[model samples]
Target: MDYRDVDIVNHQRGWDGYFKLDVYELRHKQFNGRQSPVIRREVLERGHAVAVLPYDPVRDEVVLIEQFRPATLSVHKNTPDMPAWLIEIVAGIVEPGETLPDVARRETMEESGCSIIGDLELITPRYYASPGCTSETVQIFYGRVDSKNAGGLHGLAEEGEDIRVFTKSSDDCFAMLRDGIFCNAPIIMAMQWLMLHRDRLRREAASTAI
Candidate 1:
């Protein structure tokens, strides 16, 4: 296994409320049976968090939220006709004293008004959603949901969240994928998994308890 060690050098909190820091690190690895010593220069900080990809096999659809995100709009270089809204799976930072599964369930309720049941299956955790500047890593999960009673967009307005829920068919979702409709990585991965495992998941849901 390859590994890298990072040591914090100096740090200061930024005006944007983000912590910025300098870091010294050693890249330790063996390449092609040859020992390699590489001197690295960089600064990094603690990462952010993971998002959820909710799948409701019984409805033969997936739950997605449409919300406005100013950060994404700021990065647009084109004519800027693009809406500030982005479609994503339910997500939130893991609160202090809260476990991962709890965060997943809480976010599901807060963002979409849906309740998820059973154990969460871990999908993937990636470090530095964008390692260049932010110290944010995200873990992805797939939670089982009841599709029959799944309703429309219901979000916490107090949190500035206005999410529109969509229950989309696999074929339509794939079309959206081809047209670059989804920017969130977890959602894309979840859709890919659905494309592959929808049948099995449906069968399991039919036999499983509510």
Candidate 2:
């Protein structure tokens, strides 16, 4: 498909802190096979992340978490009832020496207090949370879990995290999706994937039950 387009002329760090900002000056090949004007763009360099959707096949339920997001509050200030807390699947940024599955398991424990039962099923090629302005790719997975004791408040105190966990049936999760309870990309994608693969997952789990 000859997808080659962007040509980076220069890239410089603009800010470095909890997150990084990179300024880029570049040109791209136009549809007419000519180079377009060089433009300056600033990109947020949030590191890669991993998210795990913990599902209990026997109970047809999933575990999720709620946490405060200052960005959401900043953007939706006029709505007094729009709390900063967001409902999402377990997720964490990739550390320097961590694998995707490692982040998934660690995040699952920190955010939901649920232990993943077996190997995680990779969703597929990772996705960018916002490609136009950020270089953050997220690896998604579906992990088997026992959601019997999955509800609670869990998070790392050192990280200033106060997370609340919830377990909901697959049907209820879908209803929340329809009701606009989940606004994050990872959660939406995971739920949609589950919607399509839930039955297959259940059948496979049943076949493997001993």
Candidate 3:
């Protein structure tokens, strides 16, 4: 409920660099209102991020990106055949002076070459990617786009990003979802949200056309 509920005995910075790691020693109130033994935990302090699913309601299509993630290599070492390149929606870390929508639009262009056509529809509230070990929160959005020319390789070379973009019909995307082709959390959540609201979004896009 409050800081009083968790008694902070000690804390120290475990690592300081591009990202931070913090180690905390604390005791919290138990189910029976008793104080539990002090426990030490290390949390990764990744900053917040924003993700946008670019959709073309008129064409019934969505733009996605494929990129390699070194983090997945460790998890797939035994499988060897499992691809480390993941399919995901456009996303970026929130810069110091940028708003969530700004990040969404900027990332959409950088990752997919798709310009957002209208205001982003907030799909989900802030959610932690890995609450157990990280303090990173992500906000998700659904934004209209013109996907006719969305497919291509795009990314800033200086940033070491080699992203391949794909513009797929909603049905195709849904099939990928059913087959577990998407491994990213934001992409899965965005696709599920689109599946539920696709019809309504199409109707709105139709009205705006006239």
Candidate 4:
């Protein structure tokens, strides 16, 4: 249960952007009585992010975001001309001195125009979206909101995020899952959790309101 096998001899940053580059000197002791060289690798210093899945009980719906994801097509697409449009929960990189819930609420407002936050639920925390190269940890949350008049594209002009928000019925969202309309991993997981807990959530909402 110990990760003491790798020790840093020297380290430094190598990149300048949203993420940081980290270099580490490692020493590995072989089980067969051998010691390897002082190997060095440029590691990625992961950044923290947050996402939210907003649900509306009265409307029986959830809000999702659709945007053009350039990276997906660059890495996974068979055709270069194809656009990698993604349907995902609202998310944003955590700003300095900001709490996770605060980031979630801010992102919700920016992406969906849902100014008020209701009951919040932690879905899960996860490692880098792609651990092999990027260093990013995402904290995900779910909550109920009033999606009665939610729609249209909204995002910060400075960040170049042209996001379109969609409010769909629970039944319709689940049907999209069955039909493979949702291909993003995090959104898929969130939807699956909703599927598993929908009944209990409805019961709780009913009892609490009464």
Candidate that scores best on lDDT: 3
Ten contiguous residues minimizing lDDT sum, candidate 4:
74-83
Candidate 1 lDDT by residue in tens digits, 22-62: 54444444556554564444545544565777778777777
| Residue 57 lDDT, candidate 2, scale 0-100 | 95
How much lDDT does candidate 1 score? Answer: 0.72
Q: TM-score-based ranking, best first?
A: 3, 2, 4, 1
Tens-digit per-residue lDDT, 1-210, candidate 3: 566799889999999997899999999998898899999999999999999999999999999899998888888978776789988999999999999999999999999998998789999999999999999999999989998887879999998999999889999999999998887899999999999999999999999896
TM-score of 1: 0.78
Q: Candidate 4 at residue 120, lDDT?
A: 80
The Cα error of candidate 4 at residue 197, in Å, is: 1.1
lDDT by residue (tens digit), candidate 4, 1-210:
146765667877778676688877877776775666898777677677888888876668898889998778665656554448888888888879998888888889999988645658888866567676666788778877889889998999999989999888889999999988898777888899899888877776777674
Q: Which stretches of candidate 4 lie over 4 Å from their true place?
A: 1-3, 28-40, 76-83, 126-128
Best-matching candidate per TM-score? 3
Assess the local accuracy of residue 149 in candidate 1 as a C-alpha lDDT between 0 and 100.
Answer: 61
